[model samples]
Target chain A: MKSRVIEIVNKTGLHTRPGNLFVKEAKQFESEIWVKKGEEQFNAKSLLKLMKVGVSRGDKIEIICEGPDEDKALDSLCELIASLEE
Target chain B: MNLKDYLFEYNTISLQAEANSWQSAVKLGTDLLVEAGTVEPRYYDAIIESTLKLGPYYILAPGMAMPHARPEGGVIRTGYSLVTLKTPVAFGDVDNDPIDILITMAAKDTETQNKSAIVQVVSLLDSEERVQWLKTAKNQEDLKRIFESLTDFE
Candidate 1:
């Protein structure tokens, strides 16, 4: 398994559009991707689950990936999180 | 209060309703709220004006929408009304377009409006399976059963 803890940098954080984008990114991987906010973890591919995380700006979240292509999944997702803009 | 409580109290579910446009669909929900005395008639106009400015930001997902303005938009009380369209209506949102479910909400204050009402409704409609079940629901009992099952709503 591979994981990375990243801070939400986007002004709006993950809601509608960004949440949808993040879910789209996660679905391209074969790994089982999950996002952890505090102790709560949700399936990264589910848009509603991602929104339910309520990731506001400056909040730290962990992206965990296991199974085939975990490393690539981790890198791609971290970059997506990092690239999130207003 | 939770969605189930608001829904039951208001008795505000209109299933298989016809709407020629997004605004009309929203009107269906607000009309019920007006009749229930949850919000003033001006509240409906406020919602329409906000949507015109913000686009369809309320389209929560592919098939659902939750239309609302700020509390000061003319809220008399905090309440919600739901309208499920017989045919989907497009609100020009590329992703969450062709909305079939419209849920209008009025809150006494912005702080209370920012609470878990939207989240709880999203939880109820999160899955495609649940959304499909809701779309196929034939009566108020079916809708009530679904809302009642979510006891953990906060």
Candidate 2:
């Protein structure tokens, strides 16, 4: 299991649209990815779970990747969160 | 397609509950469905479950929440209900805090088309000014004006 904490840089946070995008992207990988804010942890592939976390702009969140391609999943997700705009 | 026909004014709501979480918002939405006669009292659980499982994602953009479930999950018909939160609730990480507007949508099919009326109504919600006006609407007449404006779009 590999995990890293990343700060949300998207101005609108990870709302429906971006959350959908993230979920869509996460499903591409064979590894299992999860995201957490504080005590709340949710499946990165579930749009509903992602929105439930209510990630907002400037909030710090932790991404956990566990699977065969853990490293690639972590790096890709971190990149996505870091590059989100509007 | 006219939204005024499907839009019902539900004044009976508990604006006090902090819908800051997904569970609360689904509860509020289910209550409205029961009030609208669209679902049986027992269906409340189903609505909540589906929302958590499938979700009514908070695409509210600002201060609105469009809570919806897939069509096959016991959606008897296509209907809409509006619920106003007294203190607003947060849906995960959306920027709009305390969602004041709750638009509950239930369709017969997930990929159903010819939803021009509903689409028009949803499009209006994208406008910040309209959403603000909806927040302050005092009565059904006031609410009607909002839907009435959709005629221009048609």
Candidate 3:
């Protein structure tokens, strides 16, 4: 298992577009990835699940990855979140 | 329960080539409300403020954006407006932006009827050809053609 926590930085937060992007990216990795915000945990690859959590800007979210490519999966997602712009 | 009855062809845009972001996107919708006489001019600011606080949520599936505000935020009645961005602007969601088609909706309540309208609109948008036609449509007649054709599909 590999995990990292990052605060959402985009001005509009993880509304729809970025949320979908994150989901699309997570689906590519052969790992089980989940995004945690508050008490809610969502499958990182499901756009609907991500939207339901309604992650906003400055919210701290935990990304958990498990599988053979867990390390690479976590790293790529961290990079993606870090690169988000308004 | 058809979208055509609820949606009309908004030919004139009061915002007029000025909107640039998610904020402006809501403004475009409210501007249509004013033109349609559904709400007051000041209502535009109210919708923008609320959506900024609550949204930027691009929930229109693939290439569309259904920008809306909750009914408590001064929605006069259940209403719908359409705005085609002259150039798309990012709503912060990559798969969704920069959005070229924005359908601003307001409902009287979360009634099944309203939900059905939303579903119908979403279904219309989900169609790739309809979305494509909406994207390339340049005038009211063109938009009307696309929207009217949706009824036949149902």
The alpha-carbon RMSD values of the candidates against the true structure, listed in the order shown, are 4.1, 12.2, 8.3
Pick the winner on lDDT between candidates 1 and 2.
1
Q: Residues A1-86, candidate 1, lDDT per residue (tens digit)?
A: 88889998887677655665777779889999999999899889776676665777788999999989999999998998899885
Give me the iRMSD of candidate 3, please.
6.3
Question: Which stretches of candidate 3 lie above 4 Å from their native place?
Answer: A1-86, B9-18, B40-43, B112-114, B151-154
lDDT of 1 by residue, B71-113 (tens): 7888998888878889999988776789998778787874455
lDDT by residue (B68-145, candidate 2, tens digit) is 555555566666667666666666543445567776666665333123323544565755677787787767777767
Winner on lDDT between 2 and 3 is 3
Judging by TM-score, tell me the better candidate of 2 and 3: 3
Q: In model 1, where do residues sit more than 4 Å from their true spots?
A: A1-35, A43-47, A62-86, B148-154
Q: Judged by TM-score relative to the true structure, which candidate is superior, 1 or 3?
A: 1
lDDT to native, each model: 0.80, 0.64, 0.67
What is residue B2's positional error in candidate 2, in angstroms?
Answer: 4.2
- Give the best candidate by lDDT: 1
- Model 3 scores a TM of 0.58
Cα lDDT of model 3 by residue, A1-86, tens digit: 88899998876566545775688789889999999888989788866556545677779999999999999999999999889895
Better of 1 and 2 by TM-score: 1
**Where does candidate 2 clash, by residue pair?**
A54-B92, A54-B93, A55-B93, B19-B89, B20-B89, B20-B90, B88-B98, B89-B98, B89-B99
What's the residue-level lDDT of A5 in candidate 1? 93
Q: Where is model 2 more than 4 Å wrong at Cα?
A: A1-19, A22-86, B9-22, B40-43, B50-56, B113-118
